[model samples]
Target: MTSPSTATLHPIGRSTPGTEWWRTAVIYQIYPRSFADSNGDGLGDLPGITAHLDDLAALGVDALWLSPFYPSPQKDAGYDVADYCDVDPLFGTLADFDVLQAEAHARGIRVIVDLVPNHSSDRHAWFQRALAAEPGSAERARYLFRDGKGDGGQLPPNNWESVFGGPAWTRTTNADGTLGQWYLHLFDTSQPDFDWANPEVQEEFRRILRFWLDRGVDGFRVDVAHGLVKTDGLPDHLPAVDGDSMGGDSDDVPYWGQDGVHEIYRDWNRVLAEYAGDRALCAEAWLPTVDRTALWVRPDEMHQAFNFPYLQTEWDAAHLREVISESLRAFPAVGAPATWVLSNHDVVRHTSRLALTAENPQGHGIGPDSPGQPIPEVGLARARAATAVMLSLPGSAYLFQGEELGLPEVIDLPGDARQDPTWFRTDGERYGRDGCRVPIPWQADAPAYGFSPSGATWLPQPAEWATLARDVQEADEDSTLWLYRTLLATRRAYALGSGDLEWLEGFGTDVLALRNGPVTVIANTGDAPVALPAALESATLLIASTPFAGTAVPADTTVWLLAG
Candidate 1:
């Protein structure tokens, strides 16, 4: 095959070139609760993270994106912040966090904490003070409050639905047995949404950002960044379906590109620009279209927003190519780089999403449920292809923990074991995320699979995961972990961090190819061997997901070719 040509891929933001290191970096997300445990409390902590810096360094990632470690009531796995600046006692002390940060930086791995600005725990001091109506209190403006009519009228200030499967507003009772003011929570009722429209709220959050940055944090992964702004009038939302009301109390809808969100991000970016060269901001944007997603990265806004289309879209070569192409093309116009993620804390793993078949694996045309067998060989192949495509693409990539090792989805959780709030809704029609959020399997033979010292872990480790633990795969060159390490190291070495992508024409539906300089990665997703292009015949193989049968590429294999 012809050696893939290197083309100039423009940066997305107005920051000077090389100033924003995150643009071309690979970020590894660590869900602290499931990462590792130090005190054997069945929970992972900062010190545990400190112990794993070497593993992350070995993975060759440029930065680490920790999910949430702040003080919380454990309602949403630490997403409900009780205190922004302090570390949760369940996780560890601030001193331990400092040590973790220091160790990570020493290993050249930048740390980015998840900052949940959309809401706070109802028990938060600000919310508590607002409840008592303290005079001249700044906390009163921290959240939205509205008067209620005692004549059986219980309307909220606005109509917004909580993301956790219910109405967003919750009414509080007054001391006189009448309905008092109501509070808005876009997610859980206990987690009240913040009033970002207030100038004081803006300044306080900005100060919070600075608080961490001054203490040596490299950046922040903003939570629900777009949800910061609400509609000005707080009008009842247009009903989508009959009986589909916001919390069964009102018809308020809460999301979808609310007004004033861009300006908020722009202002936040300006504050971040002061620390520009080394730090960055990654937004969690969930928009309907690629153009809308690009809007968040416009020059003075977020450096990069999560491109969720790929995570939620169907699996296919053609569809994947179209999404990648659109995202890449749209980014440069608005001065924001494209970011790719296959899995995160909120979604199922790719292995579960794209079920692979041993017979007909690899390629864009493969069906989502092709892999029905319990053995994950085909799923492993698909995961490898995903990594190859993600890293080879032009922008930044995010790798969820254990994903590098081809971890499959946890589908069978006992009813009582389920932790996700959504599972309890409607007789458990949804399986809840407790399965995917189980403890990481560190050692196959160790108790609790090396997730904790206790005999039992917080969640049962998939019995099938015993054969695929870190210790088991670390020694096997054909293991998924090995493939990930090699791919990550290669990308870092070749400056493949960012580049222009050229999709080869005439490739079969199951095959996808990307050219980034002198390297071309051809992934075969079918059951039969694919003929290598004449130009690639002279190329040397760097890695392959499956054994090569003669010169032609075997099915379910990723062939990395470099011109000789």
Candidate 2:
């Protein structure tokens, strides 16, 4: 295991001028907990990720975006880092991370880690020292603190609600039974928000960025990147639907986009750009509209912000076309290229999201054993349609772990077995994110579905998920994995990533036809078979979801045709 400090790190793709490489790159996101487990503890770790580097590289992704693996108390599944500099023992040692970085770089895959600067675990030494009233401590000032006064005298700086539900602030008790004044969290109460206004805090974070970059990290998928800044005056939030205040007096107090966030991101981007030197800064901004979201990627800010509209878009062909067109129009021409994500650790799997019918729509919404439903029989076809649209769009594509295998969302979890705090706090109305965060199934017949050889996994594996594991599907050329591989390989060969999208006019509402030079990708979203355009009548079929032995096309299929 070689440390990045000692390893001979190589730059990716000849360092093209500016950040153009991202325009055509395929980034594969790995949710560490579910990717693989090497310790048999039923938990995926850094070493497990290292072991599976070949799988990702073989998939032909240009880069790998790993979710947080920093040292933590397992609050928010390592998103709350107690220490940013070291690896959590459960995941593996720092040496293991260095080895993983080396291996990934060796395979021509750039590694981008998640950077959570908005907050740190409440248990972090800095926060702990602040609680002790350490004299003139720089750490104490790193967090927002104010004397309990004004308003109700017992009110927290302002009436802000936690994203996980409930009030954002928690009362602190001193050893002498005195009501000590302290400000806590914005997301999970366990994850304390940082005071970005402090100069020391800004400098420390900049150093943190440089630390990873100096260690040969390619870049970062900044977690909640827009949250570093807060409105100066702790203002009360307007009443939300539930009449609860959200996130103190801040510009971002509103549910989605806020004003002050841009400056914070711009500052971080400038610092990161100086350190990154062509590396990218992809953001996870859940802003309201595509135009508003594009504000974060104005060349001086984020290189790419995840376009979530595709995740929420309806399955109709026209609606999907509108989303892609709208995104391309919204993004700034000179900024980083646009990116798309169908599923991630935080959302329901696409299979579950798209599988719903009028009869089974409620089941698809959220519940236990949801993955085992016959929905895939209907959903897999939709999945192919979505893939064609997603890959053919003029932007980078991101695939969540197990997505290529057409894995469905997991819905069943006993009360005590739930891992997501959002689920517990929301009283099961949200069904928790645990369903999407389940361990990955690797073998159909292997115990624990090849995610582990030990007993039950930390989170229950989908009962029949083993059938869709990589090993099983890899052997079947017609499997979902094969389709994904073929699609990815073909798309790569044709420069689909960099090609300009030209939507073919006069196509039926169910058909989504886009041409990239002479190659045309035609997707059918309807149940009835549609005739191929006369212009494409003489075209050769490169790939099709259904058999293309003859000229007649099958229903619910996508055909990639090359102009003769």
Candidate 3:
């Protein structure tokens, strides 16, 4: 139970020639708007990210995934992309992105850009031209423009609802100024879904992929990976997805996880194979189960898919054990490693989520203004324990930007300051993702936590973050930031990323004990302290989330032990 400030570090052989760097890599997700801001202008930009490359490189992650920085109207942040091949002026020019990519590569870190192919901004040239042409014209053929039902086409084509809220279809004006056709926008009105059945649409994305690949990007995180190809005939049905997803996990859903999406990835895989450096593609597919999700990451498809099931599991030992076991069993069957993630830009942060109570019904999203009481201190402990257990596993782990500093969801963001489409579309019924995406605290005393030089931020940060700033944690050995650095160093020392997981029985479901090579991770999620198994009483202690001096592990804590 003794916690150490640091672990013995070793040189990793991850960069050797002929090696697939992503197989066992640790990747960090950066929400571009929240990470940093170079200009005093209220938003973060690409130059801001380039200025912080040293910070990420020292964090020990093998790769960094940049959320959409493409040109857009910021309708749904940057997900509503207008141009796919170039960086948006709000972020930076193409030269800034190239400089960032080069800087990252120089530090032995790979870069993964977000690819939002499911839809494009309404301002996109294709979509604008579609509005200017007739319903059946070639200009309108690339998107999901369909004729409405009922007399005079008053009703929508189907009963499908937008994942944000309201109907998924929005009527477009024809050349004569009459409502001509209905176009589908699964997320937001500003984002119109594309007709994947069209060969022209598919070819355009292929060229876009090569465009970024030619610029030295290592891979892509395919946004809405399962929603590209809709069901034929635009069949009508309800969908069962979580608060943060448009891609439904159910098979009956018309616009998600369709079979035709495979052909797109198969073609993409071939295109990736054409490039050197083993360029990879990871999916953001939200399938029903990891077993079903495995279908999207077959050898000829994506290299990795986010384990959403594991992310949503309740903070119970048995539930976590079950989902982790499912993820472990499912991904390897396809020669792809299971990717573990706790939080992302689209969902509530794990630190706040793990503290959900019956009163705090924000297992998905949180709002401090709403009637609920969330325990922040208790949640931080569990989040740290979960990170320890996840990194100790035998697959890649993705870390959200500010989790290391134990940042909580900004549940009290004012209604007027919120910008997520879900918030506006739902009329504030759901708080949306503004809470988890506040600008990350960097300097303890600087204005706007040093996010922007002018003390201006797109989303306001909490005053309490002063204590959790990076500079504060950098000085304290017991801080979460130090724990992350040491754990990452330890993970590389053992090469635990690409290995097998063997569960240790006899401990029951209240405690999860698994052996990965020289490390044995034992996590106790119960209300009472638990003694380590008798055989491991003599095992060497590597590190722990909470500082303790006893052989029995504290409740809601995880310890990594080195096997003899």
Per-residue lDDT, model 2, residue 355, is 69
**Model 1 residue 389 lDDT score:** 74
Q: Judging by TM-score, tell me the better candidate of 1 and 2.
A: 2
TM-score of each: 0.89, 0.90, 0.95
lDDT of 2 by residue, 1-564 (tens): 332233444544446654466777888999888888888898898988887877776677888898988889987999889999888888898899888888888777888889998889988998888887742466578887665656534767677667666676776666677676657577787888888778787778878888887778878898876566666676776434432122221234533345666777777777766653367788777654677678888877778888866666767889888878888888746455678888888766777777664222211235653434437666777776687678776778888998888888775667678877666666754455777788888888887888876745889886778788889998998887887888788888888877788988777888888897667888778877778867788998877875555354556678888988
lDDT digits (tens) for residues 388-495 of candidate 1: 778877778899999987888676656787666655542454454565577788889987788777745667677887988899999998888998899988887677
State the RMSD for candidate 2: 4.0
The weakest ten consecutive residues by lDDT in model 3 span 1-10
What are the runs in model 1 whose C-alpha is more than 4 Å off? 1-19, 134-139, 147-151, 155-159, 238-254, 356-375, 425-427, 526-528
Ranking by TM-score: 3, 2, 1
- In order, the Cα lDDT scores of the candidates are 0.74, 0.74, 0.85
| lDDT for model 2 | 0.74
Per model, state how many residue pairs clash.
15, 2, 0
Model 2 TM-score, 2 decimals: 0.90
Poorest lDDT segment (10 consecutive residues) of candidate 1: 359-368
Ranking by lDDT: 3, 2, 1
